[model samples]
Target: MIRSAYSLQAAEAEIPALSATPLDVVALLAQAHHPEAGAVVLFSGEVRNHNQGQDVDYLEYEAHEAMAEKMIAEIINDAHAKWPLKIAVAQHRTGKVAIGETAVIVITSSAHRHEAYEANQYIIHRIKHEATIWKCEYFTDGSKKWGGNCSCCPPAL
Candidate 1:
């Protein structure tokens, strides 16, 4: 369901379920389009080839679907309260994500670039820290470890 502070005709927001299918960045950007919006910000989190010097094979993501959606909606609402946004949308991928694949995407549109940029950054950061999602990383050497803290790598022992 779309969640937005403005009326349906004025804004758009969404939190889609995690899918094995690749995310369509174009479609997400399209959703944030508005005639009055002059600035649009898009953020994509992709699976990289290496992590802490390990040749990563792939990454697995899991989420509490229902709660995650709710948390994302709250984030959208908070963004609206903080900025004058035309629209905002965020989505996260679940299941195995191969190297170079898009894992998460966030789009925000506003009348000014500063608002769009700041709101976009805030939304992505909050989602990483507040959402109930877990990630497990697999390495090429047959070693694996679960990641902690969405903002950075797991703390060293």
Candidate 2:
């Protein structure tokens, strides 16, 4: 018998990996549902049109691909251990991202809404501050600025 994805067991669930392409929100959401999951939470970190009063033309993101992925997986695992999560997935873009485009995404599911919401928040915040990623902002005026993510180390020169 072919079981619905919603009926899949938690052991069948796996952590989502990091990526550098445009995130498919719909696909990610579809992967997060489980029989125990009554609540699903998604976090989309989009590229806004402006930042710091400057018009943003676009954003360029870079990362130590292997390291960032490892860190994110650890964070998600920690969340699962802390909460009753059925599944979790996260991705970060590594190339040019236009305005209103998603730069990062996190999805979490749990039997309860609070668990899903809290775990989703925890994963996104950890990715922002702990992952070895860098961001370069291309302003509308043809200027650019580089900064490290919340990681303690600065972007490599």
Candidate 3:
């Protein structure tokens, strides 16, 4: 069942390891192109230098590769089931990502702007909550901490 779904020509998903190079948004956009689709939404999650009032130097991302890929594929498949999407592609980076570098990319195409936008949002949100990707923040003050998500970090006390 998974093999058949993965064989589709329009869908693309990847979990690039530490040795792999950085993500290319243009390339990912190109991969999501579908002739019938009128709208394409692209999203990139980048690493930043500050978090919760702390000075962050960088972030290291680690994923259970096989499970991560499987979860991502499932998420994309779920998106297709929910909307009339032409194609969807998402890629996440593993290992150390410097400040200003992209950590993840998501592209979704559909016949209209609304579907494309909603699907894109849904994909990204689901990936954040569902994927087994762990993050460790390296602070400039020589401290490191783990387990807080980029979007929902706890407020400084």
Query: Largest lDDT belongs to which candidate?
Result: 1
TM-score between model 3 and native: 0.84
Ten-residue region with minimum lDDT total, candidate 1: 148-157
Number of the top candidate by TM-score? 1
Q: Can you tell me which runs of candidate 2 are displaced by over 4 Å?
A: 1-16, 148-157
How do the residues 1-157 of candidate 1 rate in per-residue lDDT, one tens digit apiece? 2333355434353336355578988877767777678999999999998887779999999889889888988888889899998888888888899999999898888988999999988888888877887889999999988974344633321
How does model 1 fare in lDDT? Answer: 0.80
lDDT scores of the candidates, listed in order: 0.80, 0.79, 0.79
Instruction: Pick out the ten consecutive residues of candidate 2 with the lowest summed lDDT.
Output: 148-157
In candidate 2 the C-alpha lDDT for residue 120 amounts to 84
Residue 66 lDDT in model 3? Answer: 87
TM-score of each: 0.86, 0.84, 0.84
**What is every candidate's alpha-carbon RMSD to the true fold?**
4.7, 5.2, 5.3
In model 3, which regions exceed 4 Å deviation? Answer: 1-19, 150-157
Of the two candidates 1 and 3, the one with more favorable TM-score, higher being better, is 1
